[model samples]
Target: MPEHASGASSKLIVESVSKWFRTPRATVHALDSISMQVAAGEVVCLVGPSGCGKSTLLDIIAGLTKPDSGHVLADGHLVTGPGRQRLVVFQEPSLFPWLDVFGNVMFGLKLCPELTNDGRREIAHRFLGLVGLEKFERVHVHELSGGMKQRVALARALAADPQVLLMDEPFGALDAMTREHLYDDVQRIWRDAGKTIVFVTHNMREAVCLGDRVLLMSQAPGKIIQAFDIPLPRPRSIYDVELVGYAARIADALRGTVGGGVPE
Candidate 1:
């Protein structure tokens, strides 16, 4: 990891942000005055139950959804709308089936109109190589496996050179074996790229493996109840005994939140 990866500089800030959704039948309070800071190049994972608004908070940070009150800041500037500097990778690959891998990655360059056609192509190739898809550049999306499709999506997002990557369960749909493989790949990418990452997942072991800090959230009208600092060494493994101990501790905290008890 680079110096930036472990440095203590704040990158993204959420200040007392709250959100609500009003329906014909009832109003759903999604978030309740949530606030936190992410260090530049740090990997932070948000873990909670289904209705705890983990994804909702991710969207708000991506500028896809605005909060009902308060606001978010990126590098001291207020985040009003989506920008290339902040990009999101959702659970679904959402790739364009009509385009080949190279073209699909180049499509993301649309957000960066400043680049020339040649520059975009070069960048596409670079990121594809970074994600170990250099040989699959001409493959169509439909021909790729589930994990391969996600690698392409990841390549596309990284091609844009986003400073902050918001991942909402990017590997949730993959098979156990595939997901385990991706866990290593993602950590390598994060370490080499040195970008701040905010990952949301329901998997406690995944969070413990990937995050420098794991934040536990309360049930709906979600608020962060606990932040667990993972003191284990880098390049963690899901099966590591020390890592499993941390996951068990986090799981207990999660259970408390879900059971209407206060989080430790």
Candidate 2:
């Protein structure tokens, strides 16, 4: 368990959040009375089948989307809208094509208007280094591979110095080898930065590899069905026999929730 997993302090509190999407043709209840808390500096992964409202819940926590009947509190204050204290890394790298790797990271620091130009530049370089992209600072977005692009996205989010990092399947698109490498990188960065993270993913092993607690959600009208505490010591490998065992158990639970098979 992480030092903060005891819930000594809740960095983010989701109180009975529910969401709905209504169209002329139909009404969809995406989330139903969903609630969870992430401790400061702890990593929690939300895992569920497709369209389980995992991303919707994350957006509400980031204040990017409004909830129908609940609220989110960050650092004891209600989250009314997106704040500098919280930042999101989406599935795509979403890097600016016109900007080099360093410039892309610098763009995220724009949220911190208090920092001097030099201060922002320093932070940008530091985060790029942290993501192992210092050598490619001048590289353009088009010139990099898929994994490198995601690394830049990770650097950009970290450069902002958000108290909570919300990632919505940020590595879902990469190839297996690249994802394995990124898994290692992300674990190292999370350990060193100690940033509160709420990650959304469908991969069972990925959740186990990165999360301190894996929250499994049911099908549509998503509700957290089970929470599994990963006590395996870091830095964990996707191939570790113990890690595979835990993932298998979670996969079984997930299949039951979805009423079908689940991807590893």
Candidate 3:
């Protein structure tokens, strides 16, 4: 568990952030004057069309990639490089093939080297249980299903005790039925663990179901064009009538961005 839970400041500030990708033919502006603040322990989802720099922005926030201008601040300190404080959970599980479930999770705790082996084991077990995978701790990665592989990944990230969790379409590849199950699990884990989360996805309903606020990014020169606050109760159903309405609005907004047309 994190040292601070509720009321602990895990705020993230993106100040005038911008990025560009240079190619032989052209220099593409990936992000433009992006700025936003994510409150401590709040779940914020980034939703946009295919070309929008959603993943690029996430990499910047994680310090995995450097921005051409501006900076990201976690709890008032600038983020220069990847650190344990801000961990990224990618679309792929990226687990070691030879490592079993328990070993894969323990690998995340390598960020906390000061802890004894037993301490790390305890943290690993606790988080695996949190993700409802305690019984399969010793199972090999190949033996697990796609959903279960992601569960281990989630546990590994949580066990690292990162103040901010950055997820890039973590469930985008899953089947619809599996994704619904994860929606419930993720919300429960976020509520109980109390960590600031920035989730990036193309799925509007996924954003509506999981995020407290959904940020819509425009195409190519990605900019935050709209932000919708989801005031619905937690453990939101993807099938909820009201939630469907919210998703529709966001989807329309995304379409407008993609087509370069005015929003309906």
Report the Cα lDDT for residue 82, model 3: 96
Counting clashing residue pairs in each candidate, in order, gives 0, 0, 0
Clashing pairs in 3: none
How many clashing pairs does model 3 include? 0
Please write out the lDDT profile of model 3 over residues 201-258, one tens digit for every residue. Answer: 9888999999889999988799989889889998799989999999989888888657
Candidate 3 regions exceeding 4 Å error are 1-10, 260-264
* TM, every model: 0.94, 0.97, 0.94
RMSD of each: 3.6, 1.9, 4.3
User: What TM-score does candidate 1 reach?
Assistant: 0.94
Q: Which prediction has the highest TM-score against the true structure? A: 2
**lDDT for each residue of candidate 1 in 1-264, tens digit (9 for 90 to 100):** 211222246798888999999999999999999988889888999998888999999999999999999898888889999999999999999999999999999999999999999999999999999888999999999999999999999999999999999999999999989888889989999988998899999888899899999998888899988889888887989999999889989888887667643222
Query: How well is each residue in 1-264 modelled by candidate 2, as lDDT tens digits?
Result: 321243448998888999999999999999999878889888999999999999999999999999999998899999999998999999998899999999999999999999999999999999999999999999999999999999999999998999999999999998999999999998999989999999999999999999999998999899988899998999999999999999999999988766778987
Q: In terms of lDDT, which candidate is strongest?
A: 2
Instruction: State each model's CA lDDT, in order.
Output: 0.89, 0.92, 0.90
What order do candidates take by lDDT, descending?
Answer: 2, 3, 1
